[model samples]
Target: MTATHRTYPLDESVDAVIIGTGAGGSPLLWRLAQAGLHVVALEAGRAWSDPSADFATDEVAQSKLYWLDERLSGGDQPTAFGANNSGIGVGGSTLHYGAYVPRADPRDLRLHSLQGVAVDWPLDYADLTRYYQEVETFLGVSGPSPYPWDPARSYPLPPIALNTAAHIMRRGCDTLGIKTSPAPIAALSQPYLATGSEHRHPCVHRGYCHQGCRNGAKASMDVTYLPAAVAAGAEIRPQSFVTGIERDPQGRITAVLYDRNGITERQRCNAVFLCAGAIETPRQLLLWQAADSTLPLNDAVGRNFMAHVSTQVWATFPQPTYLYRGFPSTLITEDLMRPDDADFAGGYLIQSYGILPIMWAEQVARSRPLLGQSLVDYLMQYPHVSGLGINGETLPNADNRVTLSSEKDARGLPKPHITLTLGENEERIHLHADPTLRAILTAAGGADLWISRRTAHTIGTCRMGTHAKNSVVGPYGRSWDIPNLYIADNSVFPTSLAANPALTIMALALRTADHFLQQR
Candidate 1:
């Protein structure tokens, strides 16, 4: 179904107001609307109504889809290319994500109990098993059946076809005695017949998944949940920038203020959900606190910012691998994700990945002093390049955080200052994983290899926990101070799991929506 782009009056009231129609808000919006609640979803960016026409396979042109807002970066390992990792449109970052949908290991939930490092999640994997299955089914995820990790259920569709790059990685893994499996992804391997009016075709293997799927095969929120929400009578307002939230004397959130085009508007709502992502959610909360001094600000609101510690190893093979033909990631190994006697508290996931020429050039520029002919020479042999990377679990450090910067954006709100430093544990994990990746590429008959350290996924800004002092939200995503306010995003994660965060974020959103429905 085509989403209804409706404009409501400034003073209009609804049962729920959701900020940012991304992976987090979109699912909750659909659930609430299906539960008979009037919901309004506010998006900060423009909606891509016609992705086939609007999106381009050209890497330089596709860079416009990223979130390029001013965000200052600091620390020993600052995220120099922050915008490249996130998106700015209606579907949020999911618009540009590779659609990897690996589930977090059950051990990930009990970090504090088992490893004695970070705080444990209020609920375990058992609490989200049903919701994970529900979200996977709704998104039509494709994966190998009888997963070795013991997932609660099987995937709805068959696994995506592995490319030559994945085949090379699998051979290397076999030689090294490492366990390998087909990577689970949200992109459809077959045509998905929607329950509503929306329909999604099979992936064309265009190798442009990160530029927003032009064929509607990717399960981005715009094509899936957002449209379904609108079909269920939910209103989605694009380019609506939420500034601050208001609460009554009883400490119940009553309204949300936002900027639409050039006008400031206020919308009254019975409940408010903040899903503006890790950086923006805390920034908005800080703005709210600045406006209302009486509101209690959680000290941990933006304290523990965590992004995955990623290091890529690009290898050039003798033959043309055509690595960019299919999905970017097709094979994965979690053998090193958790070792019984590892020095590090957490682990990492190594997977086969393919990069476009422009993206490869940009990554090279960011990491080293290569430029001009040096980079051009590397790009000259694009067809022979095959890549793999380790998405290592990062521990939440109190010092690595997002704070309100003195500089402001066009909307007169303070820009978010992000500081990310690789902890000792992460460094150790990377040191081990980097060599392992190098060895795999070597075994795959790779001649030249390039390694670069980078940041991948973001999490743990508004962490949820059992206590009020250490966490921003409770187990159900309810704010500790404001009863009617909820946070449904990766920001509420207490621990950074060694997996892509999209699936977990969706499951958590569905669980939070169910909790809200029960309360109502």
Candidate 2:
């Protein structure tokens, strides 16, 4: 399937224009095109024309898949941008994700009402149940059935086979009396025949999920939703960098202005969907602010930024584990994921993980200046190393935000400045979880433990809420000031769930697409 590409006459119009082709925009595009709406999706990076040729297992070459825009990390707990969190190209971050797709715990939606801390989502888990089921089935998600948190349905496919890393983690979890389950991932365990003649092959278990999947096994947008969208007649324009949104006197979005190569073009549309993720979505909003300072868009457009606080706990086993043989993550323990009686406001999930040698070396280097033989000594024990990572929920703080910087990019737009700091609550979760994770590893005959702090899955930049002044978009992802404008990305997440966010992001996209169709 192919999409019609519009070149520089600068005057093509569509019923709707989507700003990104990741998990968010791809599903929305497919749904809208299926509903007979003319949709154009703008992707900032080049398409993965030949995955086998373009993608490699090497770390240095694979770094090209990330979003390398010049972003300044501010405040105390500055995040490692590009390689760690964001992605580039046609599939967006899904191109390099581990494909972990756990659904958000029901408590994640009622954080305000349950714990009396952050703002609650305008909608709850009950509201998103059907959409979640739809996305899970569409992606052929594989996991243990009747998950303890949400026991409504079984997975579309059986779980991925557990690797040695998973076995090791399970042993430790059993000793600690923690309940463990197969990691729910979007990667198919068996061949899946999707809607409209699209078939996805099962995962080969190459353990390079972060790199582009060469076999079309992982459910990245490039292999899944984007192709379906193109087959349904949605125009996908690659290398099309959206600069700003054009609004009329009444502040209704009318057209999207973007630059392809060196040529500027305008695509007129009745409605616009901002699916540019948390970072670029807010950056685009700030760019629109520069265009019309008097417009009464929501003041919280770029506030309340939340990225899950992640920390890696590494240990050395007595023998070689060959941790990088299968999927990078396989076993997960969510025992600590709910704030039942915890001192922290939110909780976290512990999952088995395997890192490439280059990533491990870089992480070790960042923690302490390990040069000379010391670095070689650390690298020598690679075969005996295994690790577990914590995906802890982070509270949204207005100070931790995405703001426009004075520094400009090649497009002559101000670079997005990201200021993120760990609050007391998040720090408490880390302090508590780290020791628990270490004890588990120790019980599994592990030694030489090390913990490194990191951040994963950025969310909540363009928060959704019930009120107009407090949020950028409403419950349905429709803008309060501009009725036709909508957001279909992680940017609209109200709270960062302890679970990996890829599944929830796609679910929200599906819900927003349905709402747009209903309105039409």
Candidate 3:
């Protein structure tokens, strides 16, 4: 369905006021509005009015899709925030996300119950199993049928064809007796009509998934849920940044205060869904808490932050690997998802990776001291380089939190000060992954290895759990302090599941919306 561009009165109380129309907010808005509730989504940035026409494949040009707002960072490893993690605009980070939509393993959700480390999620995989299928179907996720994982299911769309790099990775995995499968991604492998006549075409494999898909195939929320929500009678107010939430004396949220075109307006609502993402979600809460001295202290609001151990091991192969020609994650292996010999408490996933020219060069320059002819010659070998990446689970650290920074932004709102450091489990996983990835590539006739340390998919700042005292929100995403408020984004993830977070966030968001509807 195309956008109806619905509008709602500011002072008139609506059924729900959703902040940020990304993966979380968009899905819920579509659901609530389709169910005949008055819903409005307030986005901090402009909507991709026509994504196919507006989106460009150029990496720097597509930077507008990212949330580049000022965010203070400090820790043993200060986290990278912008395009690598969060996005603004109507689609949120889904705009520039790599679109690798892996489902969380049952072990990913119940890590605490299985290994006695990291708190288990309030709801386990069983609770989210159906939602996973729903999200996959809605996104038209392309993957191998009979997914080779626990609690497996067939995909709605066929797997995207593997590129040269994936072939080499598969060869190595095959020789090493390790299982490999085509990675699941939200990008369509075939033409699909997800909602109404919104026809999504198959991916052309331009391999610019990180730079935002110029075609209407990646299933970014802008191309799917946001417009569907608008068509379903939801009001999408772009450039409206929510700064404060108002509540009654009984601790029930009543209205949302936001700035749209420099004018502050109070949007009265019976309930609010905060889906601004990991950094902004907690930042909004902390900012609200800072202004109100009477509000009870909730140290748990920004505690236990986590970023997956995103380490990429790149190798130059004798044969052309064509790293720039396919989806970044074309192939995956769960062989190490639960390794018995690992010192780390949890496991990690290995994926055959792709990289564009500029980002690859940046990594090369950051990792090595090659200069002049040496640098040019090494860079010239780009087509022969293949990469294997690790998306490892991270145990939460209370000290790894998002605190209010003294710095203020253009809107004078307190910036989110994100402090995150790798714990022992993550460190050990990195150590294991580095050698393992090197071995896999080497077995496939690769050499000149370089490993880049990184993190992606920020999560768990406003974690969901069984109780409010120890967690930021309840299992259904309702806040314990504010009865009518819910957090339906990555911020509500209890742990950083050892996979990309977009699919799970969508699943959790749908579940939260379903629960909200069930209660109504």
Candidate 4:
């Protein structure tokens, strides 16, 4: 098999087939292949082999990296899709993510046992700490030697240099007597070599992290695990969107079907890994369930949808904060993330925020309802304004779910219809923190505030648990109903954490892959 780009014959039965190449599937692909298993990965988006040629600094032009398919987002507080946070193409959302990588706290796992809301994770912090360290070291994460908030652990690389926005956020946090730390991010701080790949470059503070890092510094999967996986003899088939699964009378998946360039193809495989992300994983399961009622899936397949209540406050400063300047969200504070005095079930953490011009302009336009002149007036403050936001936990709600719409996509699969709404617990968390968020900006000599609300990190459509009745997958991401089917992505996350989900998602992938290796 050719290492760089291998293609398995459709009739050949591969040992394992994974269906996404982001933080989830890529890890499994690399590990499975390293174990000498015949693994194949399918990506729904473009290959993006060359960063310089495939990526553009322009926000609108870079949108080709996003999953812009038609999906109706509606609810009391509807989650917006596409460029804001949804990303596709070869590295998944890591391609456009701000590189804010933080491990989930131990308290985050025992939500139900600790706070009496939501179920506790089937796995624990101790189960993930080693894998977390492995992933951070693999990406050469930049951070304080000993992460201040999670000081038990240490980073492999130095933290990225602080920008103006970070400095300002630090000042405000200091004034409020809050503990802050250099955000542990995936972008390398120095040239670091992966185990089997060439040295990945460090961040240059190009101010386009959100628009998709044009260089290899940001640790997107294209520059990370995907290459390693391919180098290990794993086959990667890009532009292949999986539409269905074929199982024998025994209910074990035998073949995976997908659409590639208007051609429907099938790949025979012994085991199938569904890492199509939160939205699509449930959609695929639901589609399969609807097609055959005899499938052993329960209602948990598409239930317990969750997202972080991303409430942000923006303001202008006298000095140019240059919001678009350095590594985005380079500063963070977890001091207020777990306030025991609050009535809410879970808390939130704050991160300094920045984005490119066009994206920021659109945010102001919609948040302030500014048209021509009013919008231009806000744009004038672009150079001097900055933002700070909280990503708090929202309790898992079966109502906030991904279901098949009456509509179907080009491939004939029903389009996913996701509806999300913030419950009283989430609102209470925001109501308790919004004042402090605004106060921080005020303390930082900021003026002209704009507060915004949205949901981020699509999570928990295929949650894991100890029982088949309560969850779709087990703790190791193996489907409870199907012996040979597994899920390796954020979709299997039991709940949304206050921090970014990428790191933990990757950690879980490592954990699941390790379990698979052990079983073999």
Instruction: Give per-residue CA lDDT, model 1, range 220-242, as digits (tens).
Output: 99899988888888888888998
The digit string of per-residue lDDT tens for model 2 on 428-495 reads: 99888888889888888889999888888889899999988788998989988777899999999989
- Assess every candidate by TM-score: 0.97, 0.97, 0.97, 0.97
Residue 503 lDDT in candidate 1:
93
Instruction: Estimate the Cα RMSD of every predicted model relative to the unseen true structure.
Output: 1.6, 1.8, 1.6, 1.5
Q: Tell me how candidate 3 scores on lDDT.
A: 0.86
Model 3 spans > 4 angstroms off: 195-197, 371-373
The candidate maximizing TM-score is 4
Model 1 weakest 10-residue run by lDDT: 1-10
**TM-score, prediction 4:** 0.97
Q: Candidate 1: RMSD over Cα atoms?
A: 1.6
Model 4, C-alpha of 274: deviation from truth (Å) = 0.3
Off by over 4 Å in 1: 3-8, 80-83, 194-197
Write the number of the candidate with greater lDDT, choosing between 1 and 4.
1
Q: After best superposition, candidate 4 residue 234: deviation in angstroms?
A: 0.2
Give one digit per residue, the lDDT tens place, for model 4 in 1-520: 1245766898999999899888898888988988888988988998876787777778888888888988888778888778766778878888888889988878989999998889999986888898988889888899997878766788989999988888888899889898889999899889999776567778889888877887799988888888888888899888998878899999999999998887999999999999888888888889888888888887887777888988888899998777677897899888877786787877899998876678777778668877888878889889888889888998888888899999987666788888888899999988977888898899999999888876778889999999988889998999999999999888888889887899998899888888988987
Clashing pairs in 3: none
Worst 10 residues of 3 by lDDT: 290-299
